[model samples]
Target: MTVYQLPVEVTAFARWLTELAGRLRPDAGWYGVFAARDPEGLRACFDGAEILPWDVVESLLQDAGEPADGPLADRARALYAAAATAHDRRPGGAGALAERRDLMERERRYAESRARELGERLRAATGEAEAAGLENDLAWVRDDHARAAARVTELTTRLARVEGHARAEPVPAAQAEPAAAPARTQTPVRTPAPPAPARPARARPRGARYAWLEESAEERAPVAVPVLPTGGAAPRGARFGGGGDSAEAGGPARVAEAADPAEAARAAANAVYALQRLRAQGRSGEAHVLLCEALNGPPDRLPALAAELHRAGLGADWSTLLWEAASLPPGRLAAVAGVLADAGRAADCDQLLRQGVARPVEELAGACAALHAEAHHREAHALLTAFVRVRAPEDAARLAGADPRGLVPQLLDAARAVSATRERDLLHALRVAGLAGA
Candidate 1:
């Protein structure tokens, strides 16, 4: 059933349980009661009223839905303990006398309504097995409630200390005496503090100059040095070898090459290539670590590193890296979409796609097919019109192959001669290969 088809009573009950859970523990709000997946199980969770894994709660609800009989069944019992703990901590009123009265009347009525709902659901379970499962779930909910009680007690004690401190503080006599003073004098206007001096701009560091070189796509800058005559001149592409000692004083002379920004970027990109090679050797985790280090090194080199990663088919990881880059701005979300699209994660790509992305229509058409191949037909249909509007007839037909009926007839109608026949046969082959599952 669709998510909206969930019973109204279930939604209302879940909302109350979620609110109660939130009040008891602030962090619990991150998980909603609907995540539990079972209406009766949620009621049991509310009844027990403590912190519990959302998944376990869902399992209990599943058990409750069928013939309940398992270790997972006693949710109602567990929920009872949680509810008792929550009920104890909730304020009755301003004073103990009022609190007692309110708890007895108002709180009791609310609890009775919620409990009545629970009872009706419990009575509806058909078989002995289902009842047994429900019983087990209730028991687990109780256990969770017991564990949460100690934590709640500690929090209540701390809150009491804070409240006591607030109450014990005495009001200054000067404030009380001011009631008789003139209206203008009641608020003593103090002179405003002078604004602090603006900080001097920081001088750019020397290393920052090298940073541009690391990221630049520019050609090499010329360097002047004395050239030695090695049998008239050195041969083209000849290697020059030297040890570390050669560069020191009184040692062998060192050859100095001109600085090249493009070469440096290429070298840095090559380092990413080395990491990718590691991935090809079944060391993906290590390659990811290395990519992270390279990307983190400097702002300028990051694009080069990202490009290399994309080329290596580490597009998914690269998207995550781009997301984590502090130096990068939010405009990079398009780049993220591109990477996700390339990785065939169309649903994920959809979250980051924005207006004005530089990506063309054909790319999106391909993405539609990828999503369709993944059995996400709804998403594919959403992009189909856009694909036809932008791409060539053949490209659009290929994307439309992902349609429920397949694209053979459409391809045949659009094409001529051998091309149409080839496409028709390809469609049949795709069907035979079971790529289109029944």
Candidate 2:
């Protein structure tokens, strides 16, 4: 059963809940309409589809197909909290929590793999705007991956702790260790090759001792990993990292790095993923040493690495790389400056802009506007000194006329001081502009 959008005039919120309960009725018989493996073709089926990880809000919203926004969407809006808390008080066993933990681990690994793919794209990106956007997306993917990793760790560690407590006797470390997987090192991307769904180790009702561990992924709060739209958009000729597995596997996982981006991007992505995985595993010393090695390549490699770092949200490392690349030719400086200005790094941005900028006059204005939008001291001043140099007399007149953010005044002041220097010509243009405006 499905209710695409709740009726607009529906008064009580309980009506919406009634429909949701119907749609998500727990597995009762042989057929599971609401199951992760919906047999009736009523839901979107992908690999590793479980009955429902109600804790994963994205899966619910997607399967529920509820209109999330607009006037018609108002009634279903209450489900966000309800659905996130669905499993909070549900009963389960040790094996169930362990299964959920394994699911989370699979999801975390999938997210990291996706981050690598995004980093690969960042490598091939050339335009600063394109690179900046790719980097931004990569950063989002990275953050999401971190959240998934945390959830996995949380589930893994908590279940172990509680299970150990419930044990009748002390189990040997070698025989009864927690379900924590070893620290994930950089390895080839593995596509999940889940076979027929049979009861794997975690599927049994081993004990009800860890039922308390059945708390909703959201209830245990550090923020549950929102399932991203890593939907069925598999890469050509092969499935990418996200799909194709989220269940107990019957055979060896398939290696799947062939669909990744080309050489430059692939290498850049590999380094980034390795560093992040190492750091997440608490191998900071290894990550640091690896990072140093990655950064030690020729100067030409700095920009790509820096861009990738930025995309990965490694701000400190990104900043360092950017500074290191500062000595390179200024071909891409203007574009980089545009991004920096948008990021509120006006001083650094302007320095790059002033060193030399090759972008069109119009783009410069846009960059200045971006900077001004970010900060203004009586007026928006980005690489205005550079701006005045390339600006046409008409533009000079225009800028001098309004002096939005007092830009002309600042330029005029600077020109007054630099008149005896090489840029003294700027003083004459400002004068011409000021006279023309008058």
lDDT at residue 104 of model 1 (Cα atoms): 35
* Model 2: CA > 4 A from native: 1-348, 376-382, 388-405, 420-424, 431-438
Q: lDDT per residue, candidate 2, 7-82, as tens digits?
A: 2222122343335546653564222333544443333222111223323333344445654332123223322222
Encode model 1's per-residue lDDT on 1-438: one tens digit a residue.
Answer: 634232333333344445544444322332343434445644554543323433344433453352232212222222322333233334531243233333333433443444455456668989898877766665545444432332233233223323443344444656544554355456343333486676554543323223323223222221111121111121111011111111122311111222344754675566666665764453433444454444323333444555565776766556445323311111122233333455565644443332111123323333333344445454444334232322234443443434424443433333333256554554554465443332
**After aligning candidate 1 to the native by TM-score, how far in Å is the CA of 132 from where it should be?**
43
Q: Could you tally the backbone clashes for each prediction?
A: 32, 4
Each model's Cα RMSD: 24.8, 26.1
